[model samples]
Target: MESHVVKIVDIQQVTHDVKSFRLEKPAGYTFVPGQATEVAINKEGWQNERRPFTFTSLNHEPTLQFTIKRYADHDGVTNQIHQLVAGDELILHDVWGAIEYKGPGYFIAGGAGITPFIAILRQLHRDNQLAGNTLFFSNKTAADVIYEKELSNMLGKNAHYILSREQKAGYENGIINADYLRSQATDFSKHFYVCGPDKMIADINAALEKLGASADNVVFEK
Candidate 1:
């Protein structure tokens, strides 16, 4: 509801179409993982559009951070965020979101949808609460996988990457389906969190029901 003026302190391209921005919060910034805030940039004093992006960093410090992936040939909010440089002042709205990590179990993420899970995984790993969690990340190509090195290092066998349009050994090359999900589950009682394109989320939700994962066991962004 409320907004504050903040500065973009850092930006790093995570992939060909993805980047991460680190912001210096104005005085007292606060937000939880999975929450999001609106940011607006202006070159002419106050003439910029605002965009909402999920907070990929845990709320533990004053500095705020977010990971964003750009759409091809698009010059909208995502592109604007990519163009930001150090010392750029922007307006940051207060964080708000009801979807969050309620512990972990089975995480199904598609492409850039892995952003929230990245932050959640880090927090869980730090707290030793990720032992029972399994992540199945789907992307168009290997190059599109964000946080690959970190996920591999932290997840060990609990993590898997699925490339839908590329062939690779060990990694499945196709849309993730009920069969594939069932193969990875050692327990049917695990909770499920599905985040991605609308179609992917819909498919995953159906698959969960087919596996007897009740409505209460599956979580999705409304």
Candidate 2:
């Protein structure tokens, strides 16, 4: 599909390695909360490579935003994303995704995998659609959490954080495994949005199965 150039409006570091890029949305560009677009860096030897990034902002407006976590040692597209700066230009393709909200439920995320859930949560909050929802976010450490303050303020009492490296009073000190999911989630009937590395997602799925959640209720991002 054809894409157009979007100018970077702002950039801010959300964590040690994760950054959020806000862009001035081009005319006619639109996207949904859980949708993702391919970002193409137009540098030499970078044309044919397009990387998928989820929309971080809730609204489809004049500006677009993406929160990205870069892996330094990995020789891949994410490394290129880390090197981007404001005033730079990147090509954005139309949005697409399969793992989206059918209705509010529970969100299980790990590492940099919370991007889509953030967008969905924001939209639900904005429209007063988030009456009953829970978020279980797992990261290596406190510093690894993205949008910590914002998520805390927005989700408030309904959200929980799990840090594998640091033991905090209110946070769990381990990976979000099947046992964690079984204990934290109140209703297995509720839809589950699981995102992250393969192991985390698979573990959650396995837990959900033990909790009597149907496979159809669990959605995975492609």
Candidate 3:
């Protein structure tokens, strides 16, 4: 597969553990909003340790961007990513992902799973088509919600925050299960986009199916 070596032009901390990396976009590179590319830091010993990261920048943007969450407990690619700064280089492989926007519907995401929807929602907002879509984002705590202010501004009342660990005012508490889905969603027939841990996705898919949503209408990363 073809790979592009790009330099990190900028870096911004989106949350306590998540950082946004802006990299130089290669000429002729293009990708759908929800697509992701395998990325590896351009350094010895770790150059082959590639990980999939969604493109958070719009296709028309001059540069590429990735919003990554660092898992400090593990000696993994993301943990290494947190140690990088501007001027660092990375190798980006071919773009591929199963998650894509189907239509106006509810977006259910857990923690870093929100990365894939970042570009999709940004593109929709740029085109003024973000009215019918709602986002249900779940995190351990309010501080863990990446781009909370931006998502709220783009989705307005359609943005719902669910905290599974720390419960605070203005945020829903507990896991997003069949009960929560039924109570907050009025239309079970609409499309449902889900992304998160594999188990969470499986559970949500089952819940969606039990709630009268067809398998064909549910979109997720495979």
Q: Which has the greatest lDDT?
A: 3
Q: After superposition, how far is residue 166 of candidate 2 from its true place, in Å?
A: 1.8
Worst lDDT window (10 residues) for model 1?
39-48
What would the per-residue lDDT of candidate 3 be over residues 1-222, giving only the tens digit for each residue?
Answer: 999999999999888899999999999999999999999999999899999999999999999999999999989999999999899999999989658898999999999999999999999999999988999999999999999999999998999999999989999899899999999998988999999999999999999999999899999998
RMSD of each: 1.9, 1.3, 0.7
Tell how far residue 92 is off in model 3, in angstroms: 0.4
- Kindly list the per-residue Cα lDDT of model 1 for residues 1-222, writing each as its tens digit: 677877887888888888888888666667666677777775564345877677877778567788989775866777666777888877888777735777668889999888777778887878788888888899999999998988988899888899989998878788788998778777767788888998999999998899888788787788
Clashing pairs in 1: none
C-alpha local distance difference test of each model: 0.81, 0.84, 0.95
Q: Sort by lDDT, best first.
A: 3, 2, 1
User: What's the CA RMSD of model 1 in angstroms?
Assistant: 1.9
The positional error of residue 76 in candidate 3, measured at the CA in angstroms, is 0.9
The better candidate by TM-score, 2 or 3, is 3
- Per-residue lDDT of model 2, residues 1-222, tens digit only: 778887788999899999999988877777778888888876777866898889998665568989999989977777887788888788888778846888878888898889988888889888888878888899988889899888888889888899988997878888877777777887888898999998778878888898899888898785
**What is residue 115's positional error in candidate 3, in angstroms?**
0.6
What's the best-to-worst order under TM-score?
3, 2, 1
